[model samples]
Target: MDLAGMERSSLVKYLVRQLEHFFPDGQHDLSFRIEKDLDQALARLEVCIDAVKIWRKGEFDYLHSSQYTIFLYFLSNTIWRSRQDKRLCTKLFYLNKALNGIDCFYEIEMPDIFFIGHSVGIVLAKADYANYLVLYQNSTVGKNHGIAPKLEEGVIMYPNTAIIGDCHVKARSVIAQGVSVINKDTMPNSYVFQSNSGALEFKPCSKNILGDIFRHV
Candidate 1:
């Protein structure tokens, strides 16, 4: 994959510089440790980028805020899984949060292939997320009473929508904008809408909406 105008080494240096700028405690430099797992993280990110039809498959621009947000998440998650270094992971997590106004922690096991429409005001918890999950701005998938939602494949959470607590969001379910699905279940291949009386409503989806964003859904 092309790293915009940077080589792999240059990208590593750029990331290290950004981290150092954000966290300047002068304890230990992160160039060596971050570079160790960067290749694997980039490989994972490549798979995700390739699946999204809207993004160029072989190109990654660090200057792009949404792409960089996803990249930081992948890097932090990869390092956390590989080395289990809490300090380094925390810094990366904080960097991601500071740069992109999102609260996706490194411990949250996001899907292998997912798309972020806008990074701002997005908060994802430790939920069971499947592939082709598309999240928009101000969207949330959070836990309540220690129970998180289970989202199946081809699920799209529109802007200002939420799926919280004990909800089984079935496959190909599209949660409408500005709707909150709390402790509720959605039917497969349905559109979740809120009614006048604040009741949850489900309607069949006519087309494969995910096809517009994903290469194969």
Candidate 2:
């Protein structure tokens, strides 16, 4: 049902088709048994966040601590590699479409949210996400280490900004024009901008910042 360079041989595609079959009427019915599995995706996101919160507490027990460390790397790689994975993309595509029918994706049981610019240029390996998060063109969420980052509700990212590591970006946070965040927390009601200094700096998220962000996108 989708076009473009999408590969049918891709696993993401196969699942999407399979999922499409479940929606003969072209609508997602929450009561479908297959829908239960959707919870797994949300669980994965939560677990990733928990891992980061633990490390941030500075509890370095080596063996046990290493578990989350491995998971963190695996997640980062999964998000990136999945972009190359046709199967993953297929699943993501139909998943979004399937869930969209509900008119409230924020309450849905899903993860790995992506935008139209696509899964290819985007990577979100984040651990925590508030409802109503939106990602646009080429944005990435991975890590510099095992830092599990928290992205609050209504956060919108633009093209080519890689938000890496365990940073807490507060609610309604606006990541301004091509900025990257790593290993730090951003305050609520903030606007992030790329300074001439080559790093992302935060200021109160003013109407000016919001207007500029909407304008660029």
Candidate 3:
């Protein structure tokens, strides 16, 4: 897909271009880096689909909501996370920019609807999770004193749980589930997880959701 466009809303185009800068469009350029990124992107897409399902069943007509369209477009990129796979990566970049504009101008905060393992055993807070941040089952990023991390692009959280703090989970980091983070900084592309005890103590996403609003959602 064309990641950049003209007469397609200059502001949106600009944003898309900026986001596209994170990727270099080739395995040679980003060689061994595609697998994990693909996983993260896919994880995000899963949550996005759940959000859409919920939005569709809402009181207001979610179809007419621009937020809804932007969401679909943004999430449509997951299928292309393959390394050097220009197809989906490029599309993802395009959709990301448009979704961003909707978020900026429309004030539409994307919902945080995860799949836990298949969307289970995952841990997350109710705070607004931006588009495309996926968490594997057993992974946790609940609120600490009501503060949770706002994940950016391509963030795939692995199972076993590993996220905490009033920090921005910068784009593209794989938090190996079961890891603990508090008062710490996680840079993009790095990996993090709780110690052995931390991972074991953490419960699966299903266990946490069995009879809660989370499960129902």
Task: Report lDDT per candidate.
Answer: 0.92, 0.47, 0.44
By TM-score, the better pick of 1 and 3 is 1
The candidates, ranked best first by lDDT, are: 1, 2, 3
Q: Between candidates 1 and 2, name the one with more favorable lDDT.
A: 1
Candidate of highest lDDT = 1
- lDDT minimum window of 10 residues, candidate 2: 101-110
Model 1 clashing-pair count: 0
The whole-model C-alpha lDDT of candidate 2 against the native structure comes to 0.47
**Model 2 RMSD in angstroms:** 15.6
Cα lDDT of model 1 by residue, 1-217, tens digit: 8999899999988988888899888856588888889989999999999999988987889998888999999999999999887898999899989999999999999999999999899999999999999999999999999999999999999999999999999999999999999999999999999998888999999988999998967
Q: With candidate 3 superimposed using the best TM-score fit, by how many Å does residue 23's alpha carbon deviate from the native?
A: 47
Name model 2 segments beyond 4 Å from true. Answer: 1-120, 208-217
Instruction: Give all TM-scores, in the order shown.
Output: 0.98, 0.46, 0.37
Kindly report which residue stretches of model 3 are placed more than 4 angstroms away from their true locations once superposed: 1-117, 193-217
